[model samples]
Target: MLTETYQQPLLDSIRVIDHPEAVRRFFGLLKELIDIVNLPNGDARLVFSPSRREKGVISADINFFQALRIQRPPHRRTGRGEVEYHLTVKKSCQERLASIEELVFEPITEKSDYVAVIIGQSNAHLLTHITLRSCWEDCLLELVESNKRGPHSARHNSDVYRAAEDEALLSDLIRLADDPTLAERGQNGTTVEEPEADYETESASAQQPHNLILFGPPGTGKTFALQPYLQDGNASLITFHPSYSYEEFVEGIRPEVLGNQITYRIRKGIFHKACMSAIQLAGYGTLADCLNDTPENRHRRLRKAPAHYLLIDEVNRANVASVFGDLITLLEADKRLGAENELWLTLPYSQERFGVPMNLFVVGTMNTTDRSIALLDIALRRRFSFREMVPDPGVLPIIDGIDLPQLLRTINERIEYLLDRDHQIGHAYLTNVTNQADLCDTFRDRIIPLLQEYFFNDWSKIQLVLGDNPSWGKDPEQRLIWVRKKYTASATTRLFGEIPESVDEIVTYEINPHLHRSEYDQLPVETFIRIYQKPTL
Candidate 1:
């Protein structure tokens, strides 16, 4: 009967509600309710009763709504007594609500009699909250099914539910609460998550630790791996170079001109801004709320927020210890703002106490070719969880009878043998090869140039990697690197007009000139095939 009378209207109201403001207010109210009730297991049945003294339990009555600035009229009876108007949870739903570790309330409208219970887990930390209408048995069943299949799949099938701006607003709250710097900025603060980027469906498994480094050589898709996290516009990308400093990565004093006077002020850097964004996304209304809240409360609240990323491209280029400074300790999972052993540091310029937010993930792309993982700062090594991204030849397709996978495998094998695993050529170099021309261009323009740099202009090693060595017994025309040899006596005579009897024979190597030709006609598909091909016995 309640479903027939109020279900459709409630669903419609939820669809059109000012989700951002509603979510903000909902969390604020939820916080107050939790604080007032102090439910031991973080579960409670809130009864909005008219009587201030309701025996044993605390009545979430007029004062509760008034505290949150929610205006409600006096009780009006239908068929039941004045008790029928009080907000009540169904008997069947009570067990289900009690089972949920953390209960987040989503307010549909100021005038709505029912409060929607959004069930979420602390571990998965999904951004989309599955809104379960109060007293609706069908909605509760759907919530259980959705939780089993995951939020996105549940959202996909549900007709009555919409993630909408409520998700973003929840994210904004979480981030604000997690980062004190953003809390210090107050309501007027600007965050990286604002001006929402295009939405993307992120999986529960994609939620990684607070600090992760994707380390590998060039073209290994280290930076590309971060696309899923960035699509939601909660990510900020910054490239680290030799010149990158603690001041630039964190906070620094910068010059500003006002009127005719040049004055300096402390400016928050990308990391600082990203932290603020992450904190704001976590759901605290103010800095005091973030700072004063217990770790358990913050962690529970953060579970509702989406994960934010600080993408550091070329992470190894900057001095890790110098760039991260004292805040490097906060990068650890246990030392983040809401962790068990939370830590904080006073920034050099701002002097504001700062800690990395639990939801702010630091995803860094480290080019091993630039700086090996072994050489990374000990402090950095201790903080971040490193995942090595190596060349996966299986991802390459065979193009025009050329096995691109084998080609990449062979190149990487030779590179590994000549140098180390870190210098291996990535499969991405040949991923786009569709035909003979593409292969030829790849070898000539990209592969050969990279090998030259890898070997530091030592063409002989390049020749070996390309299967151009004399020992391989390949045809001169077919070789990617052309070799030239001359007797020392003849070479001396050519250069100085005299032959030296003691001089040894001379050898030289060059990249096949035809590869530089506009058409790339000289280097056929066979040239690339031979690099990976073995001579028949």
Candidate 2:
């Protein structure tokens, strides 16, 4: 085990290595350095130690395989037995730590002034190769640099080889590791805040809302609206359901089975991956990228920040309170990737600091009929801008036999009157009707079943929306219906001393809607076929 006495003295002798022997020494010392820093858990939890003071730590873990383990019952594990006294230990030592997939490394022939000894376990529980020199520094620098030709200079890389010239250089090294912003700031200087009007103009020109929900009644093309963006690789799609949780969407400790043994691992969820990808695509090489006013550079940076869209289908299906977790604050427009109010989070499972990027846009689709938007979590609703995607009958191609748009509008208007706008049918249902048979089939199958569910099996209310001719009464709202049925008459009693044998008879009577009669079943289909029949030119 590495001890306090040998740690600080070793940091003074740290050097960039090119030779294989020197690389071996680097890894040997790296293992000891990791032990001394108390990073066995794959996260740095100590800011100040016997060997170091206020050193910033960046914990990056890589995985090459996948596995599954129990998710419901969280397991307990042991940690360093001593009472830890460290400012960076935000969580207690006894807290369950995430078991992440072991990183796989191979040797690369490249040289650089610095190396990032990314420490991780392999699937076989063996130490993978130390990514030496060029590869190593690239890995380390990627945490800060947005692209090649970033802020790092030869002098900055050589500083780690020699003893600290001053306390300030040590502070700079820590910042370079932990805070990318600080490194960028040191290279490009500070950023001047832009006027609110200019910021608003830039935002409007982007045409991408940080968070948006596209919603309306069913079949309003809410999901279809995402196709153009998805085709361009600008959008990612995910659906939320009742079973989704913060652990699945954000981050959490999940169990994994590796070679007949159970192990826990911290896994990155879909949202986290999207945010990281957006940050990389934003082309934010330095603070200058944000503050530079040169027309060509500004335009290049803005264009380089390709908007990433996260389309959430059925956004309301999941428990919003549980799924969003701490992400609620980070989803704000100003808190986006390159926004002025950008925010970062120290993930609970991996203890890694992460933030949402501005270029990543969240687009969600919801069917208001299934669940009312008004009942949604106020916090989630406030974070997203809502766009109404009601039925647009005018966009449909003119069908040969049917006045499709008019029919849809009439049905929706009736539905709106009977129930509410939320339950109205969308125009897409009738947009493809080309003949009487097509119209009949649509009404009989898709349209009626949906209406039945919406109205709780009330066919009469459905008929009113379809504008079917009344069969039993003048008023469409009337619930009573006349029906015909076959029954055996049982009159064996004598009225005036005479008796009669029982006989079969057919009867008709007015029955209440509670019985839910099916006598008018064929009427709606026939009526729709007649209305949709082609007219002579």
**Which candidate achieves the best TM-score against the true structure?**
1
lDDT of 2 at 268: 64
Alpha-carbon TM-score of each model against the true structure: 0.62, 0.52
lDDT of each: 0.59, 0.49
Candidate 2 local lDDT, 1-537, one digit each (tens): 112233233332221111223323323433333222222221222111112221222111212000000011112211212111111111111121123223212222133222222222112122222322223322322222223233321111112221121233343333333344543464412122233233332443287677889989998989888787675444568999999999989777776543346657676677875664454344342223333334454444444465667789999899977898988998887775445655566778887667676667888999999788899989988888999999988976545445677667777887899999998888778767776556656765678778878888665576556544344223333322333332434322333243344533434333323223333433333243333332233
Tell me the lDDT of model 1 at 37: 31
Where's the lowest-lDDT run of ten residues in candidate 2? 64-73
| Superposed model 2: Cα runs more than 4 Å off | 1-205, 283-304, 397-400, 469-526, 529-537
> Over the stretch 449-472, how does candidate 1's per-residue lDDT look in tens digits?
898899998888888898888787
